[model samples]
Target: MQPDNSQPKTKPKIASSTTDPVDFDHAIGPDTSTPDGRREIRRATAASAMGNMTEWFDYGVYAVAVTYISFHFFPTEGGTLMALGTFALSFLVRPIGGLVWGPLGDKLGRKHVLALTIVMMSLSTFLIGVLPTFEQVGILAPVLLVLLRMVQGFSTGGEYGGAATFMAEYAPDKKRGFLGSFLEFGTLGGFALGTAVMLLLQVGLGDEAMMAWGWRVPFMLALPMGLIGWYLRNKLEDTPVFQELEERGEVQQHSSLASLIRGYWRPMLVMSGLVIALNVVNYTLLSYMPTYLEGQLELDPQASLMVILIGEVAMMAVIPFAGSLSDKVGRKPLWIGSLVGLFVLALPLFWLMGRSFPLAILGFAILGLLYIPQLATITATFPAMFPSHVRFAGFAVTYNVATAIFGGTAAIVNEGVIDASGFLLFPAVYMMAACLIGLLATRYMPETAGASLRGTAVPDAHDTGILADADA
Candidate 1:
């Protein structure tokens, strides 16, 4: 069923108190069936997407080029672990970034916070390109590198949540899933672009040059990409959802954290559980798979990157279709089915990937496809889990905390596990465990398909006149 767009006959009862039995029937709805709305959607998507692209590109280059980075920054002994450890260290501060930026986004507006984060993240990434190596600077090289990574982690905590919230608020209700997929598309596309560039540089410059100077090019490129994202975002108005709350003098009556803890804890926990599964699969495939293939499976480095590139492109192409499909069938069914499929296929797929290059590509492609349901629906589903007043904070804090724990550490944990036990299939087992936890949490979430973002969490509470209750 399509979402209701008609205005309510009367001003709807606002939820003034955390305990108030208020409805969100008329809280906020989609903008534009007109040319202007479509134009704004395009503009909003580009602005949000550009920064996200840069973020993932940095991640891709770092993950794909971990060996070179390790050799340059850290000492020869334990350097690979240190390099990957630095990679993981960046994630440790994500929750701090979330805490600092989330409420500010709620109070000051999403666009400005977005603008600030992009600049910070871009600068940090760009500077990494110029930092002196251990041979030149001794112990200071890795220290500076770790500091920059901390800044990158801090900025990104706010970036992902704000981008998702901004896009979801701008999107049409019935089409939210379809439109929101663009964010993740940018995510995959950015990673693919980064990987492609690294591959080209390696082929063109040879291993020595690539390790010495060529690897820096992708990090340097972040500056221009960030500038583009900033310009696009600066031109746009805040979302109508946020704008309305601002105009009504209710934008931030209390801190987003306070409001979230007082009233929105349930959705926050459920969303975090879902994030654990999403990020584990996401980080494993996009950021850690190349390492796995080369270090453990003994595939050629270039060949592993090629398989990842192919899988990323394949996944990027399918995200929108998955998002659109969820609009018709609902979020829970697709999520449930996808988790089940992953649980059943993960170990076998990991085994298949070890057999041959062609088999690895096919294995990664199938896993990427299975991941689409969650990725495509995230922006559409997670934002709706909280009210506009605390949506950014709720999503940011919970999502980042979960990612910090499960997603960021996935590579390190899998590597450690395999190193200790010599089990090549450890990542599959880890992912399977995450999938089980996710399925249990997903079972209790409201279906939320075609459900109004303005509606209250209570089932069948129709005061908003915008939604009707649906099953999970």
Candidate 2:
């Protein structure tokens, strides 16, 4: 089926009771026709991206600093595995966070929930920098770390879905793919920043100082980032789509679990499957690659960091282009291509990564580039899977549940399987399996690239003609 790139010709009736006027001529939301309107959209994008960056910065720091974290928090015998386990443990609470925060976001507006979640997430990350080591507090240190990680995870449950929803709602429909890509751009930016900081400190401070105190510096930086995100978010009003919902009194009073399940089980399941592919590749490459390279491939820590940094920066550079391409093409095509590419190349790349340092860089770069299409289109694709009223709830609940189960546990799973069976290529095989699920999900996903997300009905439901088949 051909994609519709045109905006809807007729405007929805703007409620006369609204305090703020909405320009409905544009069809998506907000008036992009005026300079001021464009500026507001930019502001909204920045607000969304900043919060997203702050959330991911913590994950990136934690992923790269596993060695230090394990050293400071766990027993020496199997400290790395324990640290990874703690990382996985944080994700266990993500669904709980989603359950609480998602409905609140849908009911309360995006900005307030985002402001609270950012502060909570950032504070939790910052406190980790100050926590006493296992040497200082013994078992209590790991316990404390676990507590803080859970808080971060909980807050993030709301942060990501809300941020993406905000960004997607504010963006023009035709440019949604391009603009939404910036959110993931923030994601890669956060990972790159954290990795860069660790690399710089490692080179400047050396091993002794790094292990002693330098590691804390990256965690400490999170507070300021969070504060900046909060400030930006507060500067803007809620998203135009959300504002319209409020004005129309069409907003859901409560996005209850039973309601969401009964209404949106299909999208939730499809999103879950897509996320399995998205985040398994995500955590495996961005989060676990350093550990895998250093421990499995025997690359030095510095080299491992460099490889990931280069690959991430490359992905960041291409993300905008890929997102723009999705606008011209469609989200499903890119996703299908990426899933297929990864499935086909996962094992060979893993094999090549084991051969040498230069080959490792080549292998990782290829995998990262292949993964970019999926990453770049996340904010564009996922949020539009449901209508605006339940967008936040649908995205948060589905995404967090999937991520908690599969995405967050990726590192630990790979490590545990490798250790138990002595199979070094298990991560690659795991990614391939995830890609298969993504392919099936993509088959049933509605093509929403240029669809309006304004009303109560599912966006592009009639255009794609897949939901009925999916239900069947």
**For each candidate, what is the lDDT?**
0.83, 0.89
Residue 368 local lDDT, model 1: 90
User: Candidate 2 overall Cα lDDT vs. reference?
Assistant: 0.89
User: TM-scores, in order shown?
Assistant: 0.92, 0.93
Q: Identify the candidate with maximal lDDT.
A: 2
Q: What is the C-alpha RMSD of each candidate to the true structure, in Å?
A: 3.5, 4.8
Clashing pairs in 2: none
- TM-score: model 1 vs. ground truth: 0.92
User: How well does candidate 2 match the true structure in TM-score terms?
Assistant: 0.93
Q: Give the per-residue Cα lDDT of candidate 1 at 277.
A: 88
